[model samples]
Target: MDWIVPLILTVITASTPLLLSATGELITEKSGVLNLGVEGMMLIGAITGFAVTVSTGSAIIGIIAAAIAGMAIALIFAFLTLTLMANQVATGLALTIFGVGFSALVGSGFVGFAIEPLPSLHIPFISDIPVIGPILFGQDFLVYLSIFMVIASGWFLTKTRAGLILKAVGDSHESAHAIGYNVIGIRYMATLFGGAMSGLAGAYLSLVYTPMWAENMTAGRGWIALALVVFATWRPGRLLAGAYMFGCISVLQLHAQSAGINVPSQFMSMLPYLATVIVLVIISSDQTKIRLNAPACIGKAFRPAQ
Candidate 1:
């Protein structure tokens, strides 16, 4: 009973990065652009955030730097895929490879270095209210930000006119173009936003979650975020549920091993990833639903009318 609250808190922290990254990618997909370089962008963000924090000793600056680094990599993807009409799949793959190598190179000097963990927020009275207080009010900034981002994403997509236009572009770029929407420009903005969010997720990993720098620190969380978008069927609310679920499984596995549950360490380590595969298979089995919900122009190359 005593361990329950702490376990829930750990799950929330684990889910934050996925929520942020997936939410951002959801917006990008809604705008009819598919960028598969999330892993690369996140890695770049991780290294950049760690490096900047180490250099300046300011976590805030580190987060900003991570966002900028992610956007910079995204800009390359946009230029290649949008401007030159390169294959989105290939360009994205290249971006990931580049990011992994780049992050490794940049993080080489900073390996094993640690930073002060981001301070948890404690409301004057609310955070002191037993179990619920710490669970709800004692989280760091990004934890709350992730929840707000989901709400904001839902509102922007369903209640705002701009969101409708972005969806229109995704549904049919040709139609959107005839209707006077700047498809390329909208996609550019959306892609950059996704990149920034992915970077922010990376920063959370290094600056808050682990509070340190390491090679390939993002691991495969970016890919999991992408899968989450698909699992949620482009719906922000569902995305939140899915992220928390995954987070729960991840924390459960970690604690199970720590508690000496007798499971093999390797098998326990694979729990989160195995769950990802199983969920993806289940969701993808419903081809009709996927077809109906997926953006019509996803992964389709777009060019302006001559």
Candidate 2:
């Protein structure tokens, strides 16, 4: 019983990065662009964030650096896919490859360095509440920010005019272009937003979750975030649910191994990923939902009229 809150807290920590990254990707996809370099962008963020924090001893500076790094990588993707009309899938893959190598090169010097982790923000009176307080009020700023992003994302998509225009572009760029909306420009903004979010996610990994630097530290969390966007059927609310679900599973897998379960370590390590595959299959089995919800122009390169 005593372990329950701690476990839940761990789950929240695990879910924060996924939630952040997926929420950002959801917006990008909503604008009719599918950028697959989230993993790579995240790696770039991780290294930059770690390096900056190490240099300045300020987690905030590190986080800002991470977001900027992510946006920079995302800009490259945007130029290739939106401006030059390259294949979105291939460019994303290449971006991921580049990020992996780039992070390794840049992070090599910071490998053994360490820094203080981000501090949790505990509301004085509220955080002291028996069970609810710690769970709700004792989390770090990023955790709160993730929840805010979900709410903000939902509002932006459903209630805002700009969001409508963005969706309009996604549904049919020709129609949007006919209506005088700048499809490429809107997509560029969305792509940069996604990159920033992915970078923040990576920063969370290095400066908050683990508080250290390592080559390729993002692992495959970026891919999971991409899957999470799809699993949510392009809905921000559902994306939150899915991210937390995965987070809990990840924590459980680690706890299972620590508990001396008889399963092989390798097999135990596969649990989170296995769960991801299962969830994807389940969600994708419903083609009707996907087709109805997915952006009509997703992954299609847009060319403005001359």
Candidate 3:
């Protein structure tokens, strides 16, 4: 019973960044743009956030700077894909490669540096109450924000006219353009939003998850988040569930190693990624579900009728 609370807390911490990144990607995909540069964007954000926090000594400011950095990189991707009509898949792969090198270069000077972790919320009596209280109210602002973003995103997608317009563009950009909606403009906005969220996720990694700067610290979680968007079939509620489920798998590996479960350390470390492949295989088997939920124009470059 005592271990349960701590385990759940660890799971929440593990899930936060994935939820943030995936939710943003979900919105990006929903707009019919497949930006596979999420991993790169997250690395950029992680380095920028850590650098800014180290220099400014403020986690909040570091987070803002990270978001801006992510948007800046995402803008590059958008310009190449949307304006120059470059190949989306090629551009995205290049973006990730660029991000990996660029972040390592920029973070070189900051290696081995550590900073104070983000402060958690404490709501007087409520936060102190046994399991339920701490689990619900004792998390950091980013944790709460992640959950709120998912809920808000769900509502926005299902209930708002803007959401409908976004969906319409994703389903049929030509039809959306014919209806007078600015298809490219809507996609640009969605891509930027996704970048911002990825940046925030990176900040959470540096400021809260590990509270330090290291080269390539995201550790492929960016890819996991991408898989999560697909795993959820682009639905926010399922996205939340999937993120936490992966989070649990991640934590389980650590616990297994600690408990001397006799598995090879390398194999234990591979659990999260292994689970990702299995889940993707299972999800991909359901072609009908994916076709029904995935955006119709995803990965297709939309050229507005001149």
Q: Alpha-carbon error at 212 in model 1, in Å?
A: 0.9
Q: Candidate 1 on 1-306: residue-level lDDT in tens?
A: 998898988899889999989998999998888889999999999899999999998888999999999999999999999899999999989999999999999999999988888889989999999899999989998888889999999999999999999999999999999989999999999999999999999999998878788888887999999999999999999999999998998788779967979988789878878988998999999999889889999999999889
Cα RMSDs, all models:
1.0, 0.9, 0.8
For candidate 3, list the clashing residue pairs, or say none: none
In candidate 2, what are the lDDT values of residues 1-306, reduced to their tens digit? 888889899999999999999999999999999999999999999999999998998889989999999999999999999999999999999999999999999998998897887989877899999878999989889899999998899999999999899899999999999989999999999999999999999999988888788887877999999999999999999999999999988887778866777887788778778988999999999999999999999999999989
Give the C-alpha lDDT of model 2: 0.93
Decreasing lDDT order of the candidates = 2, 3, 1
- Score each candidate by Cα lDDT: 0.91, 0.93, 0.92
After superposition, which runs of candidate 3 have C-alpha atoms over 4 Å from their true positions? Answer: none
TM-score of each: 0.98, 0.98, 0.98
Estimate candidate 1's alpha-carbon lDDT, on a 0 to 1 scale: 0.91
Q: Which stretches of candidate 2 lie over 4 Å from their true place?
A: 258-260
